[model samples]
Target: MADLTDRGTEVGPGEFAPWPLLTMHLGGHPLDQAQLQQLLAWELANPERAAAWGITPANGPGQLQERLDWLQALAPRHGDLPLPPAPLEQCLPLYWQLWLPLALTLKQARDELNRPLIQGVLGVQGTGKTTLTLILQHLLEGMGYRAVGLSIDDLYKTYRDRQQLVQADPRLRWRGPPGTHDIDLGLTTLAHIRTAAAGEAVALPRFDKSLHGGQGDRSDPEWVRDVDILLFEGWFLGARPIDPSGFDRAPAPILTEADRQFARDMNAQLATYLPLWDCLDRLMVLCPADYRLSKQWRKAAEHQMKALGKDGMSDAIIDEFVDYFWRALHPELFIDSLKRDGEHVDLVVEIDRDRIPRAIYSPALAMI
Candidate 1:
């Protein structure tokens, strides 16, 4: 049997911190009392939340446990262990409640469609989108399905093009906010991924943030063929244009007539990207409990970087940086309404300040 940490020996209790299953069998080992208890705990974690994810039907526990077992059997060898040393206490609930079920849901959807499934994920920075994508990619690949990740950041206009854009409109100093991406390029890439036959190579663009003194640029292309699932995610992905009148009583950082004008203009830019959103088969939103948590999280990160003697922005600068984005597309004006939108959005995973997901539900079903 393979050891949890590649030690080649059976791990005893207290070997892996926070991994409470100190005695549970692993590596295809049959279930013991500990394993059964953990499974029941996860299956009944939250009746409403589990049901929303389609994990609580009459026969759902049987099906759900199979998925959980699939995850447990795969964990020791899943490349997520032995190197980065993830504490099971911090990660296990999420793995059981979120990643396993989401991955299996995508697999079922892809199998039903008989073609590539494009999933759109929306979340601000520090919402665990990267971790989610990594686990999803490995799990699907382990099952022989090719799961590729394509971030909206990869679709930004070339550095030269963005320079020209900033020159024409000095207000556009940043790459986020609407009007920064190459919509035609994104359309072409998604179309090709959807139409390509098996064994056909599709070139996906990549970006390097370290280029041009920290202003990012397109670096290279990763070529892939016959993609089974495409994990498309971005800070603003799946965001749609809202009515401009909402900006009248806009939130702070959006004060002054100048800020209001910029907000309205960026709001208009969203309309041009509707075609890209149309390509998504399903959309999931990772919403923060309080949107201001982004600023706190950013400052905390910069402090850590500076502590290590790396260049970091000061708290005031972080405030300015975060506020600039809010002035462009305030989350209150966009995400707050989007989370309740049943027509467009499919899933909403609400997270607390600690960033652990608190609730999972389908806007459409909840509305019904």
Candidate 2:
């Protein structure tokens, strides 16, 4: 119901090119019959993708066509949507397949829970967690729900506090690892967003990673009210601690007693942050087919920065940066634990090296 323009300025039709929905659904409406045929033809060419998303050859066509028709009608309500910050067109082919299910999941939860919901999105660096959240926010808004996003990075302790950490232990200089975030701040913010009165405002904290020469620090606050849903995303959002025995033989490159000790310490630190995870009604993990892809993605990001004529981390620095995360907490082990035992993790969207969403696994929903 809201206009796409900044400050809610009214923009007449044709003021900006209406960004057409490449896929069938635009919000929730479907496409026309001719467009539906085109979409079906595209899907037919990608049978492997159809199977991956649980679309069978028999019922998939009709089912998809129905959803496409719904999206066509829903498009005008959102007006011309803005393009994403990154070049994610490669993944657009699977957009509706993923987005529609997620939208339904949230709507179902909202109808059942009868209150605002806080959903946690877990993904390693460069897996497009923020992009997915932003997309969901747009889709949810078009569905008449007010959604807001909060990053775990925004909860990092103040610059002064992190400097104290450096004094305490120089290895703690980098901020992504456990023990760097202010868990209380995240907990309180979620609580406010989940329960704030209609007129009550909530000030969300923000961190400026570009400040202090990339050491990063908290910046100003962003205030919002009437958030029907909260998307709290971070690389290690729902990570759990591994057993102490699992640290016996530290992974390679970690070949040191001190490194093993640091791993244990970080694992212990994860427990202190569990109360924050308790706030999530559901958790969605964006998993890569290969965990090592993060290294390549991070490197590519640095190269992109260099192309922009900005200071960027060198190859060696990038290696250390990516390795620090593994040393802090191995994503494979933590994510596997959550997948097997986490009560909150309801969806897992597997991503391939090409950044396309290959499949979605929903264990809880399947049981239902």
Candidate 3:
């Protein structure tokens, strides 16, 4: 009844602008004459980007006219959407052109299997994992399927629980890194979602980082029922443990012998997360072109927070904050394995400095 990608934009029935579908391609899939004409018309409107996307313009006036005719019949869906200001196809070109197709492919696999699907997304901070999950849940629902969103951050242990971690290792004063999560809770939640019958309720967990003067704590639970697909995302959702020997080299500054040992300890902690990782039907990664970009992104976010009158981390503190996770298992080491040769990961969405999808790798597309 409503536009699922709503971004606060509202239009009366039969009075909306055409959606800009410029960057996506049909991907060599067979198309009927009408569909081919639609593709040609799209190529004509956005000639420069079209060439980059590997589309060729029609050679003759006859074919061009047919394409023009198709655009005349092409229509945009109009209604209220979840994402404010505009529909996803209008606001997120990369999501419309790239990620949407990947969602459909995952959906097709879900259908063929005839079972609940749990898709895990891994990305560094500011890589837009949450935004991607929201868009995906919206897209999946638009395709007549039910989807839910979960985050590994939500599976964090309570404030008192994390106090125990602090006692065990003072280096773990913060809530992130491997040792802080409640792996048992995550496992139970995933299994429940997988087998939940229609109308069965499942309580989804939430964590509030702003609580306890930023020490963070679990908030309340949100319940949902009958989800066909579960879109689980986090900075370290699908990461695996690396060789203990890899820790000896230390990718970043390991200030002290204790820090190095803590790094090794975190790597070992990754093994406990394997059961949770195994629940994923498909794993996707959002890999930045340069891992160093995360530092800049994190700084920008903190600056914005301070501008809004909220306390923000200083540059020195941000480095320690960011490095704490890297010390566990550098994304370059863990996510790269998933990108290059990871059998578990089903798709890799490579992003550039601007956080745009530069490329998508999947077995279907065969970038691997």
Give candidate 3 misplaced runs (Cα > 4 Å). 1-92, 363-368
Each model's C-alpha lDDT? 0.79, 0.73, 0.69
**Candidate 1 Cα misplacement greater than 4 A, ranges:** 1-45, 78-84
Error of 3 at 118 (Å): 0.3
Ranking by lDDT: 1, 2, 3
Supply candidate 1's per-residue lDDT for 203. Answer: 95
Q: Please name the candidate that would achieve the greatest TM-score relative to the true structure.
A: 1
User: Which runs of model 2 end up more than 4 angstroms from their true locations?
Assistant: 1-66, 74-92, 364-368
Q: Provide TM-scores for the models.
A: 0.88, 0.80, 0.77
RMSD of each: 5.5, 8.2, 8.3
Largest lDDT belongs to which candidate? Answer: 1
TM-score for model 2?
0.80
| Lowest lDDT block of 10, candidate 2 | 1-10
